[model samples]
Target: MVSLICTLQDHRDDVNWCVFSAKLLATCSADKTVRVYYTKDFSELPFSPLSGHGYPVHCCSFSPCGQYLASCSTDATTVVWQMDSGEIEAVLEHPGRSPVRVCAFSPDSVHLVSGASDGTLALWDFTSRSILRTGGVADTTMVACSFSPCGQLFVSGSMYGDLRVWNLELKQLYAEKSAHDLGVTCCQFAPQMQKGTGGNVVQFRMASCGQDSLLKVWNISYTPHAGCKMQLLHTLTGQTAPVLSCSFSADGQMLVSGSVDKTVTVYEASQGTLLYTLSQHERYVTACAFSPMAPLIATGSMDKSVNVWRVEDGCSTHEGKFLPGEEAASSCEGGKMGGHSRLMPSDWSEDDVSSWLRQEGLEALVDVFKANNIDGSELLALNKDALATDMKVESMGLRSKIIRKIEELKMESMCTGVPDEYLCPITRELMKDPVIAAGECWWSTSGFHDCAYEEGT
Candidate 1:
C-alpha cells in the first residue's frame, strides 16, 4: 500500500545513498557532491552542494545526536561536517589510500568506524581528530560497518561475503563467518529492547543483506565465560534480484529492504512475515531507511529519485494515486500493488465513524458532516441518493474540506512547532537568543540592536 509522496529530483546523477536526521536529510550522489535539504520543506533547493570530494560520494550518516554528518567518497577520504554550519570538522584519509565505502558513528558519538576498498577498517576518535585504531586486512574489500546499540561491539561486512564481529573496547576480533554467496552490501544492528524490571536488561540482534538476494537475522548475546555468541535466527528470501540495503525501524519491530529488482519489501521483525512490497522505482533501489521519529520510510534509487513511504500498524498505507506501470492489486496477494481503497460514508458504520472521530478529531468530523449536508444519523443510515444530491451541489468544497481537515490533523499530531511567543516581532521568526528590555518583549541579539533606537525614540 506504500505510495510515493513526492519524487525528489535534485541529484544530477544517480543517488547512491540517503540518511535522515531530525530536521535535515543528506543525500550523496554519483555526481561527486553531497546535497542536504530540509526534511520539512523538500521543494526548496539546497543552499549549496558539499563539493570537496574528488570522486563520487558513496554514503552519508548522521551522528546519533544529529549534531554532525559524515560522508565517504571514492576519493579515499571521509569528511565530518558540522550539521548547523556545514563546515568541515575533519577530513580523514584512508591509511592505505583506498576508497572509503561506508562509515558510521558509535552510539555514544565518540568514535567513527569506516570501511575501505583495500580490505581495511579504521576507527577515529572525533575528540582528538586522530585514528584510534586500524585493522581488518583479510584481503577482501570491506563494504559495510555498523556499531551495535550497546556501543561495545561492531560488525563489518566484506566484498567476499565475510562478516566479522569485533570488540570495540579491546579491538579484538570476536567472530568471523561467511554470510552470503556474494558480496555483503549492508549491515545493521536492531534497536536494543527493554526486557526486565526498570528496563535494565537489553536484547541485541543484527540483520545483514547482500548481493546474494538474501537477508539474514542473527541473535547476539554476551556470555561471561564464552564472551559473545552469534546465532542465525532466520533467513528471509523474496527478492529475485540482489538486495542492496536493509534497515530496521526505530522500534526494531519492522525491517525494510531495497533491491536491484526495483522493489522495496517490509517485513515483520518478530515473525518474518512479508508486510508489503513497494515497487515505484523504475530502476534499482539503492537504499532505504526508516525515520527515527515518524512512521515513514525513505528510499533512494538509481532512477534519480527519493521516495517517502508511510508505514502504519506494521503495514504500508498511502492516499496518493498509483504511479505509472504500478498495478492496482490486492495487498493480500504477493505482488507490488496499491491496496488502499477510498472509504465512503456508506462503507463505515455508526460505531466505526464514532471511533474514527474519537481518534482523529470531533472537529474534523463535524466539519466534514456539515460540508456534506449530512447528519451523523443520516450518514450511518446508508442514504446514497441523498449523498449524491449533496455531492453534486458542492462536490469540490466538500472534498477540499475533507482533505484540509485530514492534513491539519496529521500535522498537529506528527510535527512539533515553536511557540508564537518565542518569535521576534520584527522578523516574525524564531529567536535564537532572546534578550528582554522594557515591556518584556523578546528579541534576538541582532534584532535587539535594530530595535534599540526605536525603543529610545
Candidate 2:
C-alpha cells in the first residue's frame, strides 16, 4: 500500500485525536496541550501550544469548513478554538455533575451537541451561546451524540447500552433501542447523496461497542412503526476484545474498527464481512480513521506510534509486497493484482437501477400516491428493470478486470525493479524515505516511540 502522507509527533504523551485543517494539523494530547503542525513539512516547528484542559482530552475535531476546532476533556469542560489564531473562543463548563465525553458541531456550524457522564445530552446555539435544550435522561450515562444528516433528528447512546432517537425540532424522544449489553462507543449519520444503502430515506444507523465485543448496526428509518423502535439489522462481532472505536468510510461502504485486542479490522459496511485486518500495532489499537479524501487508513496505538495504510488492489495474503518508489512510474500498471474476483458480468442481474429508488422517485415525483405505499413497489419494479440491463454493471465488470491487471503490474514492478536490499518488510504501507530504528525496525512516527524504536533497533 502507498503511504502518501505521514504523521509528525508534537505531543509528549498519548495523542487523543489529530485534525487536518486548512493546511495545519492540530492534535490534542494527554499532556494537556494542542499542537498544530505543518502537513507539508513534517520536520518544521509547530505553532504555539494551546493548553487549558485540566485533564487528558478524549477527542478533538475541526468544523466542516475547517474554521474552528472543538475539544472535550475529562475535566468537565469543552472548548472551542479559532483555528487560525490558536485562540480559545469559548469554554463550556458543564454543570457540576458530569464530565463531557464527546462534542460535535452541526452541519451548519451553528449548534453543538455534547454527551456527558451525568446521563444528560445538551444542545447549544452558537449565536446565543446558550443551552437550547437538554435531552432528558433514561438513567444511562450518554457517551456519544450525533445529529441526523437532515438535522431534523438527533440520537444519543449511553453507557448503559441504551440508544435514543429524538425529534430535535419538537425536543421529544421519538424512539429508543437497547443496542448493547454495554455502553455505545459512537454514532454517525450517513452523509447526504451517499450511494450504497439507505439512499435518500432520511435514515441513520448507530454502532454500539462495549463489553459485548460486537459492533451492532441499527436501521433508524424515518417511517416510525408502533412496535419497531429501531431495526437491529447487522452485528459485526469477530473482535477478540472489546471494540473501543468504529468509523464509517467517506462513502459509508466500509467500516474500520479498533479493539483492545491490538488489531484494527476493516469490514464491508453493507455486507458486514471482514475485508482487512491491520496487523502492525503491538499494543491496543486505540484510534483508527480513513482519510476523508483518500483511500488511506491512519491508525494510532498505545504503542506510541501511528501507521498509514492504503487501500490497494493487493490481497490480504500479499501484505508485505512493495515496489521501490523510483520504479512506480516506469513499470506502471493498474492496481488490481489478484485483489478480488473478476467483476461480475454486466447482464448478470439484468436491471441497472435499484427497484426501491425507481419506486421512491416516481412516487415522490408523482402527485397521486398510493393507499398502501405503492412507492416501495415502484422502487422494487424500477430496480428489477434497471438491474436487468444497466450498462454500469458491464462497466463495473470491466473496471474489475482492469483493477486486477493493475495489481499484477504493481507486483511485477516490485519483483523486478526493486533491489533486494531496499525491500522493507511489506507492512501494507509505503514508507517514502523510511528511517528504520537502530535495530532495523519500521514504526509509525511523529515523535520518538520507545516500543517502535526497539523493534526497529
Judging by lDDT against the true structure, name the best candidate: 1
> For model 1, how does the per-residue alpha-carbon lDDT over 191-299 read when each residue is reduced to its tens digit?
5522222212224678899988998888766532245567788889978889998988876888999999999999987778888899999999998887665567889
Candidate No. with top TM-score: 1
- Superposed by TM-score, candidate 1 places the C-alpha of residue 315 at a distance from the truth, in angstroms, of 8.7
Candidate 1: pairs in clash: none
Clashes of each: 0, 33
Prediction 2 global C-alpha lDDT: 0.55
TM-score of 2: 0.62
Cα TM-score of candidate 1 = 0.66
Candidate 1 deviant stretches above 4 angstroms? 44-46, 193-202, 314-457
Give the Cα lDDT of each candidate: 0.68, 0.55
Q: Model 1: which ten-residue window has the lowest total lDDT?
A: 332-341
TM-scores of the candidates in the order shown: 0.66, 0.62
